[model samples]
Target: MAGAIAGTAILKNLSPSKGLKTITLTINNDCNLKCPHCYLQYGKESFLVGELTINSIFNSDFEHLAIVGKEPFVNKSSIALLEKMVEKCYLKNKSVSVITNGIGLTNLNPSVANYLDYIDVSFDGGKGTYHLYRKGSFDKIIDSIYNIQSKSNVTFNALHTLSTGTINNIDDMMSVRRFADFKIIMFSPYLNTLHDGKNDVSIVQLEEILKRLSQSTDFVETKESLLLMDIYHTEQEGVSTETLKELMSFYQLDSKIKLIEKDPLNYGIIRVTYDDYVLTPYESIHPKNYTKSPYLASGVNLNQVFETMQNAFS
Candidate 1:
């Protein structure tokens, strides 16, 4: 994983002189499950506006491509686009990843699975916990995971978001043992503007959860994923800079898990509502101005997009 970071840095330096290493493309906004914490204002209107043509992705210079959305599998056009992109990328020897809720993985057309290198299924927890956040169909999700694993050559990683209601069942979450990879993400209560208006979840609670997760064989001993520390800071106010540094130091000492800083260039990894080719920091995707469809200027050329990003950083 350190190699991934080093490689990213090398690529960042080289990208200005060369080209980008990874490009995350959001194919559509339709989703089967309407998660409570979803940043995308996804509904029929939003979904209609979120569609992007497959040709745009095929023409892009991204070596590693991710097909993501509100629920990428809900949109047949997006899935078709992904199949085409994957086949193209596979022929070119490029890596392709899909971030999905895992609802559509089961019974997927055989051709679709062949194009994917990896699939990240959002498994906040087992049946009970995930239903609290995502509502309705935990069993279906579990079935989807099993079904996808059975059919595809794709590797599966569980993406768990530690939140107020969801964090209590850490032990229960780790009990399920089928995942090839496990990533524990710290939840930002603030992200759900509708529910947690003030977005309050105590730091003591988060630390305790992390401590418990770190000790659990079901979680810590199994495949470890990067800890999202910044999310912890975002929720807790008056958390001095020094305290954050110490917390990071504690994480380094306690776990072998790598810390993935949100890239300044593309915050759309998590929230893919719109497309604006801006050089803004990764965390800045939630900004009002940048969250809509890509500006015509930004969509014109990939080189222009890179130049715009470079200028923003400079």
Candidate 2:
């Protein structure tokens, strides 16, 4: 979640509150594909967040929840958990979204889609370029998108990672917009590589592409996509708690970190790990090898954990 920060201005406005509005639950560490760029720190055994902790989170003040995974739809077990999460969200009057790789999407219960606000399918690239990073599944993912859209009224959006390899086939990737029913095609810079800009799209190149995407009529532009221009302009050697702190210090960002400075009850985005640790999205994604995060037990008061996050980020 905390990878690159371009300038002081960008740091001053890390993200608007809307971007941080959801609490993402990483339900499992199981998946069907082995993408070279996968960010997850895979565990030896399959992991699933317990229902009690999930219910507690739904009962909390967060207005939205996101169900994500190594691939949430990888198996029937994960798909069942997704249905439960969606039911909880509906009962609590909160919106919900699922970010999936579209590996097993068509097999899901059609009724589940009616409760969802969004179904964000991951599209690393398209056709020739996608197979380079994700390997042999571009056609599968594309079919999943088409099938899901035809079966349900759920809003569809595409999440594409712009990397040194994929950027070269920008036209092939953008072609998905012409056929898929994506309301917004979001983009995130590939940040799993070393801090050097070598494996990433340079700021200058990304800027030009962002400009075109912003002005294009292919799909609706989103604030989240526009903010990426700032994220790519800066790069770090690695992702860690210290490296993130240094980036903030170098950018002279103190209370200016408006991203998580608000009351803990309403921090930008909170992440609940597979084992039930409450953490910021940055800590959950980076893990212990890169960052250190407190182990807030599953049943701990949600407010207390939120307070800890406020102190850490604000």
Candidate 3:
């Protein structure tokens, strides 16, 4: 809620020839910290996806690529891989972004910013509760943001998870704008499977919070959050018409914002694992079922995979 939300696009029925807007790759298998809310389970053996696999996707029609890791900058090898990926994206004339924990970023070569379009730092809570959910230095993360902003013109964003805890500490969330210039504050609901039910938030609760915050500063409610609300709309007595009308009114008020009405699986976003399996963004959310579904092999036809994805979700 710190800055104006960008125009939203209602993506649906995209053809394989046009391809996806973005693809997220899990580039590394190691992380410095293990947050309770995160679904990724890091193993002892560290692995970085091969460059061939990376280039294969870059050759496709996707416009952008987003990379994540146990912690992308967790070590020298990981940073090296990230730098290489950024350079590859630059060479391929594709936009690239990364979601980092903001710890190993200090070691990043400032030149990396020349190719990187965005850096979305993950922050679930502010100050007091920052370390409560994830054991990282809160000040260090903020300092890293300040450091990166000074070095380059790359856009910055804060990726947060919404829960009872985050709502209670809403003041801290509001204060993020004071520390750094963030282009957008993106919020996603915490998966019930990942944590205890005490912190679980219902669709009605999420809508109320958005109603309150929407009055102050613009924020982005992710496709996953929207999908959850749709499910709630179908299953429950129904979301209040006034609440829906108020929230939907923002779409008309801001010409830049387009509320995506498509299902999460149809959002033209794919996730590639560290081991090199291509999956739909919806599958990536259910980490427990990551191994249960049949995934497309990264080396195969990516466009064909996209076609399959559209049909399956349609």
Candidate 1 C-alpha RMSD relative to the actual structure: 5.6
Provide the lowest-lDDT 10-residue window in model 1. Answer: 1-10
Better-scoring candidate (TM-score), 1 or 2: 2
* 1 or 2, greater by lDDT: 2
Give one digit per residue, the lDDT tens place, for model 2 in 1-314: 22211111122233445333456677787878765455664445487778767766765676677776657888888889889889878887988888787878877776788898877777667776777777757777777777767888887766665565555555556666656767655555555533211232432243343443444433223222322322212443333444444554454432222232322223356777677777765455454432244554457756556656666665
- lDDT tens per residue, model 1, 110-165: 65686777666666566556666666566776676666666766655555555564
- What residue runs in model 2 are displaced by over 4 Å at the alpha carbon? 1-21, 193-267, 289-291
Candidate 1, residue 79: CA error in Å? 2.4
Which stretch of 10 consecutive residues in model 3 shows the poorest summed lDDT?
Answer: 1-10
Preferred candidate (lDDT higher): 1 or 3? 3
Cα-based lDDT at residue 89, candidate 3: 86
Model 2, 238: alpha-carbon shift in Å? Answer: 12
TM-score of each: 0.72, 0.73, 0.77
Give the alpha-carbon lDDT of every model: 0.48, 0.58, 0.61
Number of the top candidate by TM-score? 3
